[model samples]
Each structure stands twice: as C-alpha cells, then as structure tokens.
Target chain A: MKPLPRIVSVLSAALIIAAAIGFLDAAYLAAKYFTGGPIACSVLDGCDTVTKSAYAVPAGIPVAVLGVMFYASVLVLALVFRERRSVTIARLLAIAGAIGFLASVWLVSVQVFILDALCLYCILSAGSSTAIFILGIAVWRLAVARANASDAAGHDSTAGRLPAVGNK
Target chain B: MSKSSIAILGVVVLAAAGLVYLGIAADGGPAAGGQAAIMTAEDHVKGNREAMVVLVEYSDFQCPACAAYYPLVKKIAEDYANDVAIVYRHFPLQQHRQAVAAAQAAEAAANQGRFWEMHDMLFEHQGEWSGNANAAELFAGYAAAIGLDGDQYRRDVEASAGRDRAQEDFQSGRAAGVNATPTFFLNGQRIVGPQSYSEFAALLDEAIAQNR
Candidate 1:
C-alpha cells in the first residue's frame, strides 16, 4: 500500500472528529423528539426550549441532521481527494465549515442572551465544528506549501541543466 | 526542525490538548460543586441528598419563552442527573389566558406520577393547546394520551388541585427572586437568561469544586 501523505492523515482525523460531533448532535435531538430522556442542560429550561424552538430545524430539517450532512461531506471529501488535489478542496471545506460554525455560534449566543436557555448538544456541535474548521485550514495551507515547493524544485532541476552547445 | 513544521506540530498538540481538556471537563471535575435536589420521584426516597447546585425554574405554560427553554432544562437534567435536582416552580404570566389551566394540568399529571413527562408534553404542544378555545379539553386529552386515568385527571383538573399546585410553584418561584421564567440558582448563585453548554459547564464545575 502507498504511504499516506501527512496532510491527508491530519485532515482525515479532523474530519472524523467533526463527524463524531455531528453524530452526537443528531443523537441528542432525536432522543428528545422520540424518547423522553431528560436533556442534559445547565440553564433553566434550556434544553427543552432550544430543542423545541423553530430554529432547532432549518428548512424543516433538524439542525443536527444538517450538521451530520455537513461533517460527513467534509470527511468524504478529505478521504477521496487525499494528498492529490486535496489542498484546494480541503481549504474550501474549511472555509465553508467556518461559516457554518460561526452561524451556529450566533444561534447559540441568541439562545443564551435572547432566548435565555442553553442547549448542551448544540454547544458541543458548535465547538467541534469550529475546531474542525481551524484544523482543516491549517492542514490545507501545509499541503499547498508542500506542493508549491515541489513544483519549484522540479523547475529548478530542469533549469539547472543548460542545453549543451558545441563551441564554434 | 523547520519553522513551518514546528508550527504544524504546535497546532496538532494544541488541538489534542484542547480535546483532552474538554473530555476531562465533560463532568464536574476538581471544580465540581454540590448540586441541589434534582431527585426524581424514585430518587426522592433516597433521603435529601442535598444538591450542590440549586436551579430554580419559573415557567408559564402559555408563554413562548418558557416553551423555548424546555429543551435547555432537559439537557441539564440529563447532563447532571445525579448531581443536580432542579426545583420547578410556576410563574404564570397574566398575558397568557390558558397559562393557569396548563399549569394545573401539569400538576394533575404529577398526581398520576408523571409530572416530568407531562411537563415536556405541555411545552412540546404549547402551540397546539395553550390559548386555543378548546384548551381545557385539549389539555385533558393530553393527560389521557400520556396514560393518566382520564376520569381522575379530569376531576383533579376541574377541582382546581392542579391550579393550587401551580400557585404554590409560583409562590416559591417568587420567593426565589425570579422575576422571569427560567431563572437558575446554581448552588444558590442566581443567574438569569439562557446560557451555552460550555458556559454552564465552566460555571457548574466551579461550583462543584467549591462545594467539594
């Protein structure tokens, strides 16, 4: 088997963690909707209010479900494009993740400051997604630099060998 | 090592350390405080296991604010089930017409040994029955749907026993300095409004440690 590139390994791990966070987020919401498991919250009525709120779902789908989809897509992209053509895709994924994560943070802030409650699962998902975005950007940058250096070296070697001309 | 390589390693280590910190902080660790009485009916028999944190929730069934906070409270209950016992008092605002009846319905459900379940149901279906014309009958139907004896539930509701319980909850909430719905007393430290899980976790851990 060919050795995996260092950048691919790092990004893959980050993506997996992001996916796990998404899974947990989905589980928490589903449990509330389906089962009567006491939600884990620290604020008063925090879990119930946030989970049952309209914002809990975007476009009629649970936000947790969307989180899962987003994380899974990132993970899939990281795995499929690993090393080769990975940097560009990874950077794009990171940028998208950052936007999504920021949006979630904004929602959580509203839930706290405006709605006056805290949803533990939502917080968890937001934190994890933020970390994933950070890591994805870092890894992508590293991959790009490596690719650039190699390209530069290929040119240098070709340029170093001047065409031999017979002395006239 | 190259400067860039060092930076990469630093980022990886920092990320790893952060995850570890989060994991350790998942439950109350060194800063774990004593939680207030959050015992379920079953755990009530275990004697007053004085909780280190006391959470006071002022709620009105008809109020959208209270409905919004339902999930947040549930999360706290699950996250710190053994350590925290929340005291749910009622604070029915005047603006909501059916708030009183809904509160009463919840108390009636408590009589049937299903207060929490009915509490969740009330919040979840707040829009469906809170201020509707058929609120009384609709709420009664919910009690039945949740497996409470319909006849007994109806009698208690009509007799105002549920209403009395709700009033008592309201009185207690007022005494606790709650001017709004969903106020929290984390170890007797009062905080108002909604909070994030990370924020809660940090505060809760601090209380736990202090109590310990």
Candidate 2:
C-alpha cells in the first residue's frame, strides 16, 4: 500500500519522454506511407533507398506502423505506472522494454547489412526505443527493491509471525 | 490495472489515434498534383511516346544517385515499352559543377539524334567525368563515339547552345517540384523511385492497369 520509490517515478517519466519521441518519429513515417507522394532521395547518399525498399513495407504495412504501436504501448504503460505505482505495471514495462531493445537491434542490422543504408529518422526511432528499454528496467528494478525493503521491515517488527505462502 | 491506470491508458490511446489521423489528413494522401509540365512533341521521350502512362524523370546527370537510378530507368523503358512512355528531363543542380555542362552535352547530342545515347554514356561513366575539369572534352568524346559530327559537337559546347535547352528543362523541373536527382512522375503524379527492377515493373504495371 506504501508509495513506490522516487526513482521509479523519475524513470517512468523518462520512459514517457523516450516513448513519445519514438512515437512521433514512427508516426511521421506512417504518414509518409499513407501519403505516398514525392520522396526525394539524397543526391549522393541516403534514406530513400532504405525507405523505398521492399523491406520497408512488409505485407503492405510500413514498419513505422509497428513502431508506433510499440512506442504508444510504452508511453501508455509508463504513464500508468507513474500514477498507479503497481508492481505488475512495472513488470509489464520491463518486458516491453526488453522486447523493444531486441527489435531495435534487429532493425538496425537490416539497415546496415541487408539494406546497406541508414535512414536518419529510422535511427532516431531506434535510439528512443533503446532508451525506453533502459528506463523500463530502471523502474522495474526500483519497484522490486521497494517491495523487498517493505518485506524486511515487516519481518523485523513481527519476529514470531510466519510469512504468507505462495506468490511472493 | 487500476481504474486510474486504465483511464490514463485510454486517454493516451485516443491521443495517439488522433495524432495519426491528423498526420494522414495533413499529408492529403496521394493525389495527382504534378506541377511538371505535360510531355509533348518537344520533350525527349522513349518507348511508347504516345502512351497514357508516362514516366517522366527530372534528373541530374552528374549526380551519383541519378547514376544509380540510370540502370533501373533503362530497364523500365525496355520492360514497359508498350505501356509506358519514358521521358527524361534535365534538372542539373548548381552544386555539381559539371551538371549543367553534362546536360548541355546531352542537348548537343540531341541535335544529332543521339541524346539518349549521350545520356546513357554520361550516367554509365558518371564516376569518370563527375568532377573532371575536362568534362566538356570527355562529353565530346562521347559525341564522337555515338557517331555525331565531332566538329559541330565542339562548336555546340563552346557556344553554350545546349545550355538554353538544359535551362528550359531546369525551369520546368523546378516548377514541377523536383529538388533532387531522379524524381519520377508517372501519369503526372509523383511516385517513389523504385530500388529494383521488379519494384519499378510492379509500379509500371499498376499504372498501366489504371490507365486502361
């Protein structure tokens, strides 16, 4: 029932900011896809090759759409944890972050190895996704620490009492 | 999730949905709003010159990306010979010191019924004369190889006769919203440049089908 650690609140705020950036970057690309208008590739080097490639829109859905979904969930998850301070919420964020981090790794590899080109906007979204993963872990760790501290306090106060079994 | 958590999530979801809607609406989706002038008898066209599905490219010869796109465009011209009319216009950028000169060379070659040949040679060997100070001489060599009157080609280059034509294409390209090399407009609507032959073919096929 006690309030979660201050660090959790701080990290949740960080997650929200990171996720918002990722969301915006992804949203812009999705909009570009919907518009399907003139795409000017750089004269000598850059994004048009990557974006216009087949890999960019797998199954007719822009990869940015997937990014939007991931980041929006992160943004909402972080916001919820900030207000509710629920351990379940913290765990969810940590899981989401881990998934996002792995996905970014794969996305970057595609840009470098398979596509052999880097898109500035795609890189920006990747950075934000990585940030969300890190911040999520920080909040989840703090929540676990707080729960452990409270349990320790309870044990010291009630020396003869048996702890409840199952589900820690 | 608690009531407050659910409420916050719902609010954020609604906000994201609203943002996406605005993004799409603001972009106005794809519409046929090409400012590039329609190709006519004066324009340099290849393939079915009278076809309804015309693919016009505003391109710079010295640009590496345009060079990269050269082969792809060549393939498209061949594959869609019956359905698409391929038009190439000069969009020589100022930054590439020799872009205007290269465009001029093509124009000179055009006077001899060899513009596309010069266009192909320039792009195929872009790396050779890209920044060469003797670019005009290199172009003259191309003029000879393509079997043009070498003497007249030299005179055309020296007099800047081809420059006037390059300038017209440049002006029209600017009007058409071409700010980069290799900008393609299919049926007066801009379409993303394809990365490969199949991608371009697919686009051409779609356009051809629509034209019918």
Candidate 3:
C-alpha cells in the first residue's frame, strides 16, 4: 500500500484540530446563551455585552448554535477524508470551510464595526474557522498539483485514490 | 459508514455534551461574582438582608436592556422583599457613553444612602439622558430630587469615592463573570432565559425552597 501524501495528512489534521476548537468555543457560547448568564472571558471582557446584545440571538437562534453546527460539520468531513482518503469528502470539506470562512468574516465585522466590542471567545472561534478555511485552500491546491503531475506522467496519483473496500 | 467513523462521531458528540456540562457546573467558576455573592458592608442591599435568596444584579444605568428589566426587577424586589435580598452592582458598558457616569452618580447617591432611589430614577429616566451630553448634570439633578443633601451629593459625585465605588462593583461583577447589564444571579447562580415576571418569581421560589 502506498503511503498517503504528506500534504493530505497534514492538512486534514490541521482542519480537524481547528474544527474541534471551533466546536468547543461555539458550544461554550451556546451553553452560556441558554443559561442567560454571564459569559466567561479570560482574556477580553466584552463577550457579555456582545452576547447580551440583540445580535446574539437572531430570529430565535443563538449565533453560537450556528457556530457549533458549522464546526461540527467541518470536524466530520475532515475525519472522513482522513480515514478514507476520499476525494468527495475533501471537496466537501473545502466547501464547508469556504462557507465557514464567509460566516467568520461577517461575525468579525459585526464585532469590530457594529458592536464596537471584542470578545476573546468569539475571536477564538473566528481564528479557528479561518484556520480551517486556510487549510481547505491548501488541500485544494494540492489536488490541482496532483492532477497536473498525473497528466504529465501518465500515471494516476494514488494520493487522490479512494481507500479500498474491506480494508477498513 | 465504517465502524471507526461511528466511533469517532460518538466521541465528538460526547465531548460536546461534556463541555455543556462544564458550563453549567462552572467547574472552574465561582468567578469573582460567585465568590463575592456574599454581601458586604459596602454593598447596596434592597431587601431582607437576612433573606436566604440573594439576587445580585450587575447593571448599567444607560443600557436599554437594563432599563427594560428594571420594572421586572423592581416588581421582584417588592414581591420577594421578605424572601429575597436584591443587591445592585455596577457593570457599565463601554459602548454606552453615559453608563459609567450614571453608575458613578448612583454610587454617589449610595454614599448618601439613596442608591436605590438613584438607581430607579436613572432607569425611569433612561430615555432622557441615555445619549444626552448633559447626562452627568441630569444625574446630579436627580440626586437632588431624590433628597440627597446638595453639598454632600455634589461632593460624593465629584469625589474619587463615587468613581471608586462604581469601579469596585464593575471589577467585582467582571470577576463574577458578568459582561452585560441587568445580569441577575438568583442566589449566586445566574438566572438564565426567563423574560417574564412570573419566570423570575418561579426561580426565586425554587431558591426559597432550596433554602428551607
């Protein structure tokens, strides 16, 4: 069996870590929102203001819940790609990462320009999602590179192949 | 899905649940708010200090949410006056320009033993001075209206004691893990998600029962 590409493993691992971190951050915020209590801020103190603001809950759902869902999806997709080396899962990871990235941009904008306060936990969440997005782009570039190399050499890239059935 | 995939997902789900549990337990908490839940000689108390249920509120005078909850809190203070002790603390936000000043003014009133009067007055008239440039002056007038001695009120409002008092509460509230205004802790545990008057009373009842 061929060793999986170093790039694939590295990027997948990075995505998984970032997504897990994002999941924790989002989940913590969601819990605090549900409790309707004060938010814990070890670094920055503006989270309570942000969370208590009207913007915290939109159309009845706390924004933190959305974050939890998004990060959870990323974690799952990254896991599938890591295990099966499935190109479909990788592509989906990239897509989810793009979506999360866009969401992060909007959230950061809300904090800096609109809310005028910074929350340490919120910033952690934003950083985690941004990292996943960057790793997704890296995975995408690797795929393109593999495709080009395969075209020149007339040999299929094993790195992009799906894991064989019954091998699990 | 492969067996390993199922296993991985199960772990993620469990971890998520554990995090939530930690939040409720506040395993590392009793933040300054929780630790300081015990009343002090300097605290502004509005009910039976001997009551078993102590409801501490971290609030800002200019915050709309705090103002909105003012009546609900006022009602709670009255309904549970004998069963609950309501403690007011300052938590002025940076966004609201007049919040800190209002808090300081309330503290000045506190020096004259008129904290609650100033607190209620500020909330009732929040609309008048929320964004007004003359908020401090308006607060001084309120102080006078609330029957605080003019000379003492002015001295208290202008002196470092007022600012220090407000800052003290602000820091304590922050230590207690409060970020927003009108954050109420019924018996030192935060009151989460109940917006109506009944909902608050229900929690207080639970606390009262627990005490007995």
Candidate 2 Cα errors over 4 Å, as ranges: A1-5, A24-54, A57-62, A155-168, B1-11, B26-35, B38-55, B59-72, B75-174, B179-182, B185-212
Q: Per-residue CA lDDT of candidate 1, range A1-168, in tens?
A: 123355556665666556555545554455444433222232222345577667777788866567656655665555443423455666776786677678777778867555555666677777877877777777666656655665575633322121111212
Let me know the DockQ for model 1. Answer: 0.05
Best by TM-score: 3
Error in Å for residue B66 of model 3? 4.1
Q: What lDDT does model 1 reach?
A: 0.60
Q: lDDT at A53 for candidate 2?
A: 68
State the iRMSD of every prediction, in order shown: 10.7, 6.2, 5.7
lDDT (Cα, tens digit) per residue for candidate 2, span B168-212: 888887777666677788888877646678878898889888879
Location of the lowest summed lDDT over 10 successive residues in candidate 3 chain A: A38-47
DockQ of each: 0.05, 0.18, 0.21
* Between candidates 2 and 3, the DockQ winner: 3
lDDT of 2 by residue, A21-90 (tens): 7887787777666666434444332445566667888898778889888888888878767765666788
Here the TM-score of candidate 3's chain B is 0.83
Order by lDDT, highest first:
3, 2, 1
Q: To one decimal, what is the Cα RMSD in angstroms of model 3 from the true structure?
A: 6.5
DockQ of model 3, rounded to 2 decimals: 0.21
Candidates 1 and 3, the one with greater TM-score: 3
